[model samples]
Target: MRYERADLMTGMVQEGLQALVDGRHGDPFSILGRHQYGDLTVVRVLLPGALSVAVIESETGKVMAELEPIHEAGIFAGLVGSPVPYKLRIEWPDAIQETEDPYSYPPLLGELDLHLISQGTHYELGRTLGAIPMEIDGVDGVRFSVWAPNAQRVSVVGDFNAWDGRRNPMRLRAQAGIWELFIPRLTHGERYKFELLDAHGNLLPQRADPVARSSEASPSTASIIASSKPFRWNDADWLASQAKDRTREGAMSVYEVHLGSWVRIAEEGNRSLDWVELSQRLVPYVKKLGFTHIEMLPIMEHPFGGSWGYQPLGLFAPTGRHGTPEDFAYFIDRCHEEGIGVILDWVPAHFPTDVWGLARFDGTALYEHADPREGFHKDWNTLIYNLGRNEVKGFLIASALEWLEHFHVDALRVDAVASMLYRDYSRNEGEWIPNQYGGRENLESVEFFKHLNSIIHDRCPHAFTVAEESTAWPGVTNSVENGGLGFDFKWNMGWMHDTLHYVSDDPVYRKYEHGSMTFGMIYAYSERFMLPISHDEVVHGKGSLLGKMPGDAWQKLANLRAYYGFMWGHPGKKLLFMGCEIGQETEWNHDGSVVWDLLDRPEHAGIQFLIRDLNQIYAKEPALQFSDLHAEGFQWAVADDAENSVYGMLRTSEDRSSHMLVMSNMTPVPRYGYRVGVPDEGRWEVVLNTDASIYGGTNFGQMDAWAHRSPEHGKPFSVALDLPALSTVFLRWRG
Candidate 1:
C-alpha cells in the first residue's frame, strides 16, 4: 500500500495520544498532538511488522528502543500538534491478499489523516465551508493558504482589483508543501483567483475561486466571499413535514429551463433573469406545469456568453452571474417550500479552459492526472480527473456532497456521463490510455461513480440522480448490486434518436421505419429512463422540434402531438425542453430570446393546451403508471388502413379494467369508421383528442359520445372505433 501525509501546522507542542495502528508489514503510524486548537500531525513508517510503536523526541531519536506491538486494525484517533517530518522502517513476513477486483480494497472514509512530523509555527489557513456569506468578523488580515506543493510560485487575483491575476504573490512555505499569502483590508465582493508557476518556469493559468458565491460569465475571476454562514434553514423540520411519495423515476417529469432566458429583468434593459427573480417567478410556474422537477442548465461559474453552463470554471461555487451565495441558497429554499424539486445539470465529466479555476491546478497535473492520455478530453478541450488518485477522488466526491448538503438540490443530472465511463472516449486509438484491464471501461472511473452514487443515496435517500448517457453502456441505470452505475434514470438516447428520425422523415419514408418507435422499449424495460428533449438537440444547428418536422403547419402540429402522446403513453418518464410545449418556431438560441410572442397565436396555444391536458390524463391513467415498464403494459398493431400509415395500441393494466386505447393515423386523409381491437366490450369515452379545436388542431372529432364496444376477440370481447387521420385519440372504457 502507498502512504501519504496530512497537512502542516504551526506554533504547537507535540504529544502522542495513541498508537493508531500497526501494519502487518512491520510498520507503525501514530497520531500526534499539538497545543494549538484544531491542529494535528501524523507520522508513518514503511517497514514490515513493526515490533512496537512510540513517540520519540528530537533529542531521544536514537537513545531509546521503547516499543509495543500494535493490535488495532487501523487508527481511529485524531491528532494535534505542529507538523514534523520523520521516517522509520522495520521487517516482517506475511503474504498479502490480492484480489482480481480492485474495489476489494478497504474504503477510505472521512477526512484523510496522515502527515509528516514537524516542529514549527508555520501552517496555512483554510476555510471549512463550501461558500461564505459576506460577513466574516476580524478577517481582514486573515492569512490565505493553498496546497499547491508542485507550484514554484503563486499569485492572488480577484474582482477587488479589476481581475488582476498577479497583484499579490504568496510566499512558499517549503517544509509543509504549501504557499501562503495575507491580504489586509479585504472585504466582501472582492473576487479572487490564483496564478501558479510550475517547475518548468512556466506561469500556469489563473484558477477560479472554488467557493464563489456568484461569478461573472466564464473566463472571469471568482469573488472572495467573507467566509461566514448565515442561512437559517429548518432542514430537520422541512424533511420531517415533507412527504415524498414521488419515485425517483415515476415522479420524474422534468422541465429543462435556462434561468437566464426563462424570464428577463425589464428594468435592467438587456439583463436576463438572475437567480433571485427566477427563484420567485419560476417556483409557481413549474409547479403549475405539473412537472415533478426542474433541471437547470449548468449554473456553475463559466466564461463566454454562449456557454450553456457546460464549460464550468467553478466546481464548488454557484455562478456569480446571478447573485451571491445566499441568493442561490434562497432560491433552493424557495423551491423546496413550493414543493418543486430541482436537478442541477452537473458537469463532472469535463471542465472549461478555466485558468483561474482547474486548468493546470497547482502548476502541474495536481487536480488532474499527469498523463495527457488519461487526463485530457480533446473533443471537449477539457481535463478529466484521474479517478484512481485518492485526492482526485476526494475532490469530486466532496464536490458532489457539497451540492447536496449545502444547496439542498433534490437531484443531480450528471452531464456527459459517457465521457466519464470510457478512457478513449471521443479519441483515436493513439490518443488515450488503456485501463489496467486494457479496455474502454475505465474501471477506476466506474468504481468512483458507483461509490459516489452509493454515498448520495445513503446520505440523502430522497435525492434523485440521473445520467445523461448516450452510449449503449449496459446497465447504465441498473442497481449497483447488478454491476450498474445506479442512476435513478438514464436519458433514453435511443428514443430521442429513433423518434427524431421517424418524425423528420416524409410520410412515405416514415412507413419504412415506423417500427423505430417500439425499438427503444426494449432498453426502457432494463432501466428507468427519461425521454428527454435536452439542450443537446436544440443547440449547434440541430434546430427546434418544429423545424425538424417534415410537413406543413397542420401536419407539423399533428406530428408533434403524435410524438408527445406516444411518449406519454410509453413506459419511461418524460422531460421537455423549455418553449417546446408552446411550439417555439425557431431553433433554440442560447443568446437570443425564446420566441415567446409565438404563444399569442392560436396554433401555439393549442399545442400548449394539449400538453397540459396530456399531463392531466397521464396522471389519472393506471396503465400509464402500472408496470409503466413491462411489455405486458403495451400492445401494438397496424390500423386496418395500414397503407395510409396508421398504428394503434392499448396500454392495458394487469386487471384490465383500467386500460387505455391509443390510436393514430399519420395520413392527411381521414379514415371514417376504421376498426381497432380492444380488450373488452364497453362504452369507450374519448378521454383525449389531438385534433381538438382547443389545441389549435383542426376540429376532426367530436369531444363527446365517440363510444364503441369490442367484438368477442380474445379472452372475452373486442370493439371497433372511428379513427381520424393525422390525429391521436385516447379512449377509456366505462363499463
Candidate 2:
C-alpha cells in the first residue's frame, strides 16, 4: 500500500536508526522529518547500498554535504542548507537483513495556540496547525498563542471585550511558545480580532482568526464567532457511506458555484442564501443535474464584498456570510448524502490586503519576502506567499490536509496556478525575477506545487487535485514521475474560446470558418481536460452564453442548444456554469440572483430540457464516457472540404461491441442527404437529436429511421436524410 500522507511520519523516523545498526544493513539509511517547512515530508535513501552516503538537493542536484550519525539510538541529524529537497544516502560494510523500524517519532498531535489581546493592531498567531484549546467555561477565558519569532508583543480583542484595543495583553509563555491569558467571563455571539507588536515595538496590523467560525466587521468592534454549535450533521452515516465510495479523477463533473449568489436568502431581500438553507435546498438539485461534483468558489473568510473570493483572510474558516463552521460541515455532509461530491475552491495563491492576516504575519518578511516587488502582486494588489519560508509552507500544507481530513471534501481545485508557476507570469521583461536560465518559471513555486500535489495524493488517494492552469505548460496532466505538475485534469480554455467564436458567427459566415470551430481539437488531445463555460466566461465584459448569440430569441435558443450539443460531443469532459442550462440571459452577478424566472419561458425551458437530455445521454452512453479522452472516441473528417463545415466521428469502445457516431453541421445551409462514415454495416438507429422539438427546434429529420447496408461508406448501414441546419445527430450501429 502506498502510504501517502499517513499520520506515521514521526514514528518512521524514530525507528529507522536501530534497524540500521542491528543488521549493519548494506542499505541507504531512511531519514525523514517534517522539513524546515511544517509539511510532514520524507526523504528516502536511494544510494546507501552504494559506498558514499551523500545528501543532495533535489531541485539543483547540488550536494549539501556528507552526513554522520549522531551518537544516539534511532536518531540521526545532518546540517542541510536551504529547504527545497533533502536527499539522504546510507552506506553499510555489507548487505544484511532489514532489522531497523526506520520510522519513529512521538505521536503527531501537532497543534499550537494563538492569542491576541488587542484590536486594530498587528499580531502574530503561532504559525502551525497545532490545536489550540480554550478554557471557555462560559464561552469566555479562551487563551491564544502564536509563534511570531520576530514579534515583540501580541493581544486579542473582540466584541466580547468591546474592541478596546488596549485593556487585554497576552502574557507570553516561554515553555509552550504561546501567548495566553484567561479572561474571567465571556460568552458566545461575540466577535474578535488580534493585534501584534513588532521587534521595535511597532504595532502590527490587526487581523481576523484564520479558523474563525464566523466574522462581522465592526467599525467600532471586531469580528465575532459564537462558541456554539447550531448544526447536527448526519455524519455517522455519511462517513460510513463515503468511506466506501471516495472521489476519483475521471468521475468528477464539477459545477463551480458561488454560495452567496447561488440562492437568495429570505431576510436579505433576495441577496444571498444562508449556508444552512442553501445546503438544504442545493443537495437534491445538483444531484438531479447529473453533476458528480460541485466545486464551490472560495468559502474561506474574506472581508471584501465584491471580491470573487480570490482574496482570502481566514485560512481555515468558512466565510461568515454563509453561517458557521458546523454549518459548512453540515453543507458538506448534505452534499455527500445526495451523491454529490464537494471540492473547495482554495486560494493559497495570494492573500487579500497588506493590513490583515497575511500582511506582515510574523513581522520582518516572515510569511512573505521583504522586497515589495517580489512579495506583492501588482495587478491583484495581494500579498504573495513566501513559499520558501518553513513555517509558511507548513501552515499552508497543514491547512490543505486539514480540509481533506476534516471536511471530507472529494478534491481541491487550486486557483491562480499560472501566477504561482511563473514569477513574471503577468509581468513584462525586467519586471520580475527569473529562473536559473534567466527564464520566467519560478523553480521554488514549481517545487511547492509538486510537493503540495504529492502530499494531497499521499494523504488522500481518492481525492483529486485539479489546476486552473491557463498557460500551455507541458505535461500538466501527466503523472509526477514524468517531470510534470501532477494535476488530474485542466480546464480547456482553448475549446471554450474557439467554440464560442465559432458558434457566435452567423450561419452564412460559418461555412467559411468551419476550421475555426474545430481549431481547439488540434491541441485538445495533448492532455486530459474539462471543457467549461465557467464563471470566467460569464462575468465582467464577457457576456453569458445566451447573451453572446447574434440572432432572434428562438435563434439564440437554437444557437445555445447547438453550442452545448457540440460541446458535449467534443473530445473532453464537460462543465456548465450554474445558470447556463436554463439559458439565463443576464451575465452572472456575484451579488445578485441567477434570474431563475427565465425557466418559465418555453425557449429557456427547451434549453433546460436539452441540457437534461444531454446529461442523461452523457451518463447512459459508455462510448461517450470512456472515449471522451482517447483518440478512438473521436474521428476527424475523411473528406477535407466537406469535413471542414461538418464534423463526423465514431465513438468506439475497446471490445467494439457497440459504437456511436456523432455528426454535426457548422454550416447554415441544409444538406439534402449527408454521407457519414461508420465502422460497421448493419441496421443503424437514430437514438438522439439536437434538433428535437423538446429543445426548441423544429424536428428536422425523421425521429425513427432504419438504414439498410451500404458498401460505399465501409459501414454496416448508411442513412440518407435531411441533415438539419446547425444541428448535431448521434447514430448507433444496430445488430
lDDT at position 216, candidate 1: 61
Q: What is the C-alpha lDDT of each candidate?
A: 0.63, 0.63
The clash count for each model shown is 47, 60
- What local lDDT does model 2 show for residue 241? 55
- lDDT of model 2 at position 41: 36
lDDT of 1 by residue, 1-735 (tens): 322223222111122222112111100111222222333343322112334433343333441222233223321222323333211222224332211111111111112221211211111111332223322232233344555767766656665434443334455545444454444445455556666667655766666555444456544465465445557764554554332643542435778988777765557785777777887777887777677678999787677657678877666677767777788888888887776678898887776656566766776776677788888878777787767666556556666766777677778899888888888888887988787767888898788778878878777765768899989888877778889887878888889999788778887776777677667765667777788887778778888898888788888888888777777766777889888988887788766566778878988878878877887787777777664656677766343343667677677776666878777766666777666556665677888888878877777863433334544323245555556656778878776
lDDT of 2 at 497: 79
Per-residue C-alpha lDDT of model 2 across residues 266-339, encoded as one tens digit per residue: 47576677667877777777777777778888777677857777787766667777666677778888887777
TM-score of each: 0.77, 0.77
Ten contiguous residues minimizing lDDT sum, candidate 1:
20-29
Instruction: Give the Cα-based TM-score of candidate 2 against the true structure.
Output: 0.77
